[model samples]
Target: MFKSRRPGLVRRLWRSRVVTESDGHSGKLHRHEQRSMTHTDTAPGLTGEAGDLTEGAEREDEEQPDDDRGAMCVPEHRGSRRGQESDSRTVTCCLFGEWDFRPRSSYWAARKDGAGPCQCAPRRGVLEEDLASTAHAFLKRLKERSLDALVKAVETKGGIPGECVMVPNTELRLGAHHISPYYLLCKLFRWGDLPLSARLKPLCHCQSFGAVDSAKVCCNPHHYSRLCGPESPPPPYSLSRSDEHKPLDTGTSIGSVTSGGHRSHWCSVAYWEQRTRVGRLYPAYEPSLSIFYDLPQGTGLCLHGHHRHGGSSSSSVQQIRSKIGFGIVLSRELDGVWVYNRSQHPVFVHSPTLDPPSARGLNVKRVMPGFSLKVFDYECSSWMAEHSVKPESQEGPWDPHSVRISFAKGWGPCYSRQFITSCPCWLEVLLNNHR
Candidate 1:
């Protein structure tokens, strides 16, 4: 729980690892038992794994198909909310905004029942003339196949959870590049589009079809969780309304977020040198957001001081600091934590939310300049932890809640060096147990 605190106490906590924010009172620091980064001795360990820097470490990759009329239900009424009743047939397909976020593009127009939460904010409609006819046709075809999958299941005396309906992996073309069939289908039916290879899990009945780089896969929109994220959008997220408001622009408050009159922190941002902690812990709480940058700031995490590259002897302290540039801004929202790469260079990120459900693989994303990503999806994170895996390899480190990000350069087997300790500058985003 968090409450408005004496400014002095707030300042002290920011300047040091006060660890536990008070419930308008005081408490002790805790090393929460969450997943940790690899090379624990050399990496910035999480709560319970805390250790002073004796050394260094840190660091950190979808489809569809088609069918018939009895294959799907005919719409009687449209645009209703869940729990509220209507005369139309029940929607046997995915519905955007049902997955922890607001919808993107359009919603289920032919559905008989209402949709889910935080009803989407009014969005400006796209002009038909502006979009290619092929794009519209592709989307329409997708909807037909989505419901057709359900109809097949019902016909066989099975249900939405019965089987994976086959689909072309690259069925739709938008602009110059092709898009993942399931991704676009999910965007229209599941929810908003995401940047990271947001993994989609097939229902138990469709699990056999879940895999990477498959030429053919399931197209049942309801087969995948409505919470589907992107799977490397080489075509770009141009299809989603590009002008929509950004996560950083939200007016969420920072350290003063509260729950039951006590303070609650979503996560703590820590800058590091090899394994040594640099600066104070920047706790991003709910209702507000904060930034981690190299420049002076009235508030948020300002990464100052010099850092020496333990592994790379050629780079100097000034060079490492320069790499920070404007750094990134990490925000805590009711849905999850977001990171905006405000710096000039790309930042490599690894988080539990980035774990692909189908393969159980941990992906390190390369977030480029001026780009932002929902680094952690709270709902997804919780779901992953339930079926958590302890990856014991250099390519992966298991943590359903914690996140690690390396700046400027990258680490791991593909890079010149391995481990976050070799990274000149990096960050450890340790999520709070309470969140």
Candidate 2:
């Protein structure tokens, strides 16, 4: 009985173990099959579907005649290329067309800076006015011709016996000419006006005359006293003067002051005359209002000196600052100051009067090495102190009557060492009190 029971139990245990192992193997195979199916389904969702659609379309296209395919593709390719070219052309026009919208003054400024040719369109208002004037003149001439012809015809036909000769009327219509709108637009927008260079020629000639005359009279010592006479020697060129007043005509030889006793301020251009190692003077000329004097580098001192070392010690270390180039525009009504950076490094300008406090302080303007800036409507005296010091004051009274030009940074003065012992430069605007 024990032997039979032992054999049966051993058979059952072996069968159960074999069944469990088979079940585990089957479960792993099922999971792997599911993962493979999921990967295959998701991977082909969008890209594979699109590729299949494209292939089907391509097969259909291949079935069609080659000539038909070429004909269809040629136009599509040409259209795309033309569209790209048109977009490029539009971008170019947009870039250049902006100049046309700028003010006339801006155009002149850009020209002065030696910018590229301006693609600005003509002034619409001026074009319309010109066209209207031309049309009116033409119509007037036509009317006169028609009247003359009518009279001649009547005279040939024997003048009307008693009353009047009635001539046949002819209708005049501009539309009959069949003028193109494009042609008209082109005519109206064409830049046909004189250039800035051409307009400046006359003014430049006048200024040149003044500058030459002043140079001859001031530069030659023999001619100076003779031309100026014994009563008063030609006054030294100064940034500002108050002691002596000379008429503009006598002082500058450019323009005469108003006879009505109204005070008029004039802009002066002067060259620095080095008399000795420590002595220098300015000889001025009244430049034309329409022209600008380009102050070259290493030519004249542009700033006044602020003594770092006191007394005689300051003279030993006195140095002229870096070379600078700038321009000055002066007029009774309009004035401007412009700076052109001609150096390898940046420059800074500080004007207590012209610039706002925010800009005058540590936030001074940084003029890049090759850039320029135009400040309009500048007045030299506008920056002067409001209060005046009494001449009797023991302390060195502040000279409220001075033009100060200061530069914050640059090479210490070397070229102008013979003339100036300071860093900055100043000019005095002399008020002409002579009648």
What is the TM-score of each predicted model, taking all chains together? 0.41, 0.24
Residue lDDT tens for model 2, 75-183 = 1111122434343321101111222333554322222222233222233223334444443333233333333432332222211111211111222222212221111
Which ranges in model 2 have alpha carbons more than 4 Å from their true place?
A: 1-279, 288-333, 336-348, 357-401, 406-435
TM-score of 2: 0.24
- Each model's lDDT comes to 0.44, 0.25
lDDT, candidate 1, 63-89, per-residue tens = 001111121111222233334333332
Q: Using TM-score as the measure, which candidate wins?
A: 1
